[model samples]
Target: MPHHPDLATTVRIRLIEPDETDAVAAVTEAAYSHDYELPESYRRSLLDVATRAAHDQVWVAEDPATGRILGTVWTPLPGERISPLARDGELDFRLLAVAPDARGRGIGAALTRHVIALGRERGARRVVMNSGSEMVGAHRLYLALGFVRLTDREGPVEVAPGRFLDLFAFGYDLD
Candidate 1:
């Protein structure tokens, strides 16, 4: 596949540093809170970048000019096997969020492409993820990037007691 166009030239996508944990959490929580009714456990999971970075590669898209975080995505690396969503031969990512103010600026798409690239580099046969069903804009972006819905894997994931979010699974076959 040809390289995706550089959608946001001013934003640099890289592994976030330790000092930027709070910033990353703020951006992720702010973004997710806008649409998802996050329960306390899920909220804590989103804010715990350090735990994520311990096993997976936690990346962030930052505006180089201001060093402000625009978005974040997590990719499970080989051997860590920490993902609850990825099946064998699939690389999984979670908590892909772009700051509310950064929507429509291509930040989310850029972050998605970055994860796909990482998967390819690591010899992963496919990239998969589960997204909330209500995220129509994110669904559109994933479809535009050539992801296909895996309805067989669709189900409800409980984020808190008695509260569940219907998840739509998507996959990009690298082979």
Candidate 2:
């Protein structure tokens, strides 16, 4: 596949640093919770950057001029297992969130492309992720990037007690 055009040149996507934990977490939480009702448990999970950084490769999108964190996404380390949605030869990412204020500037697209590029570098045959069904904006971005909805994987997932979320699976074939 040809390289994706750089969509957000002003935003730099890079791995998260220890000192930037709070910033990343805040951006993620603010983005995720914006205009949506989130269960407290799930909301807290969005703020758990340190845990994700320890287990997966946590990445951040930064505004180069201001040194401000604008978004984040988490993917497994190269050749490691993380999301159950990924099988052998597949790479998966989760928790793609862009700051509410940064919505129309292509920050989310850049971060997603960064994940796909990471997958390509790791010799992955496909890249996949599960997004909340209500996340219509995110779905649009995924589709624009050549991801197709995996209908077979669409179902309700238990997030916390008494709360279930409808999730849509999207995949991009690297072949």
Candidate 3:
């Protein structure tokens, strides 16, 4: 995996340690729950940081001075992709969430910037993520950060048995 033990970000971006799994999971779930009515399975998935960490790398954005986690996001290990939205040479990230209380502090943006850096460092031609249509704020952020909508990848994703969420795809070209 790529290591950035000392990212010089105002909001420190680093791996989510074992002890912080609960905190990060809470932030992620709370952030999403505020906007949507999550099904039991989806809610459980949001709270299961360990499984995400086991599959990819879970990262947290923290208040540098206080060491408090403000947000969380996960990306597949270098040269890997967890979301089908990503094609070869693309790095895909998912579950980006900033604690409701921490919004407007740029924690989300910082985490995204960190992910972009990770993609560039890993020699990816692009970085991609899929977001639900309800996440308007997140869409603005992605666009402001230079991500473009990927119409071809937009579709409905099953969040639970016989249930679905309309997802839109976005990509940041790093080339």
Candidate 4:
């Protein structure tokens, strides 16, 4: 439960450029590990920003004035396996990250809204996403954006040999 100041007014959502790949990966890994330690598999996935950008849409929330990437999100386009969380007919946004120091600036929400808009533009019937149960702030944001708790999709996944993470799923119907 970190407190972020309200500063979404200055963030701009855009696709990440090739030169910014390392920054995007670093931000994503840092954001997720803020609450818990990441396992090897999870770490590998987070570091694979380039592969994700090649197959799907990798977006970042940037500070227009400073050209800093404050946040990042990955959207799975149709027929692309950008994320295991996404299924057919839906756009799944995964690995949403707002830098620890940048949380209060509304960067996470901006990246999320950008993904939802991408879903609509791709003619998706709905939007889907998965978040760690410990991410209370992100959960609140998703609920406020009209995403509902999909209890049926909730489950525990082994992130490491003896450690498991319970994932919470949320969905927003496009209708």
Candidate 5:
């Protein structure tokens, strides 16, 4: 893919450093809130996952000019064999988001590709993400990137009265 100069020229993706944890959490909360009403506790739980070694493999895309985080994706490293769909291996992608003001500049796609590359390098057979069904745009992007719908599961939490989340699990085979 040709890199777009207008989309923050010096953008780079790197492992999340300890100091950027708060910024990562803030961006995740802000980004998700745009599409869904996440409970404070859920947001906090997401943030807390960054602190746990076994569950954390976060990456942040930063703007080189101003040193601001443009987007981030949290991917868990490959672990015990999980399922047939996880045949290649598994890297659970969570909390992927681009800053609101930075949308449409390809940051989200760039981040997704970055994580896929990371998964390949780490010997992951596949990369998976659970996205809300209502996030049509994101689902489209995932499909565009070669991710196939594996299954759908009910979200663990309900954000509205009589309303439950339908989370779609998508996967991309690395090999």
Candidate 6:
């Protein structure tokens, strides 16, 4: 399918590859700031898993003009946390991010839909994601995309002063 012309004039979504690991990391670092402090090792591990040929599936949105990665998302099949409602099949969207400069341009929404489509293609009956409380906008987007909040848990790990954010778990039935 062609890229959404209205949102990303010359952007295209493609499966992420090993060579694009650095670009994916760059986009992740640029998209998330002050919210979560991911250690270098954690980032490396995520990238490694995302690029792995096994169960991980990563996708990227590239700007045809600059040939740079504008956004990316990855799903881990056979989710880590299995909910009773997701016993059939599910795809956990581990990460969804768009470059700061690429925000408000529908890039995030496009990437999200792309991931959902990917899940459906992989025979997933539902798509799940964990959104931090600090990501209000993202939570709103998920809601708009028909994702319903299943539950929320207070983060035990404190990253900042007195700011104990909660992780809101959202799920979307692909059927």
Q: Which candidate number maximizes TM-score? A: 2
Better of 2 and 5 by TM-score: 2
Global local distance difference test of model 3: 0.88
Tens-digit per-residue lDDT, 1-175, candidate 1: 2343665578999998988889999998999998878878888988898888876788999999899999999877674455467777888888899999888778888899998998898888999998888898889989999999999988888767888888999999999
* Every model: Cα RMSD to truth: 2.6, 2.7, 4.6, 3.2, 3.9, 5.0
What is the TM-score of each predicted model, taking all chains together? 0.90, 0.92, 0.92, 0.86, 0.80, 0.75
Model 6 off-target regions past 4 Å?
1-5, 34-55, 77-87, 152-165
Task: Please write out the lDDT profile of model 4 over residues 1-175, one tens digit for every residue.
Answer: 2334545558778888999999999999999888677878889989899998988778898888899898998876565645466677788888889899987666777677787888788888878988899888889989977899988888997767888889999999887
Question: How high a TM-score does candidate 5 get?
Answer: 0.80
> What's the C-alpha lDDT at position 53 in model 6?
28
The local lDDT score (0 to 100) that residue 15 gets in candidate 2 is 91
Per-residue CA lDDT of model 5 for 107-138, tens digit only, reads 88889988788788888888887777788889
Pairs that collide in candidate 3 are none
Please identify which of the two predictions, 2 or 6, would achieve the higher lDDT against the true structure. Answer: 2
- lDDT string, candidate 2, 51-164, tens digits: 999888999988889999988999998898676678899999999999999888778888888999998999999999999978898998999889999888778888788788
Judge candidate 4 against the unseen true structure and give its global Cα lDDT, from 0 to 1: 0.82
Q: Give the per-residue lDDT of model 6 (tens digit) for 8-102.
A: 47678988777777778777766775356766655565456344424666678888888888888876544443222244477777568888888
List the lowest-lDDT window of 10 residues for candidate 4: 1-10
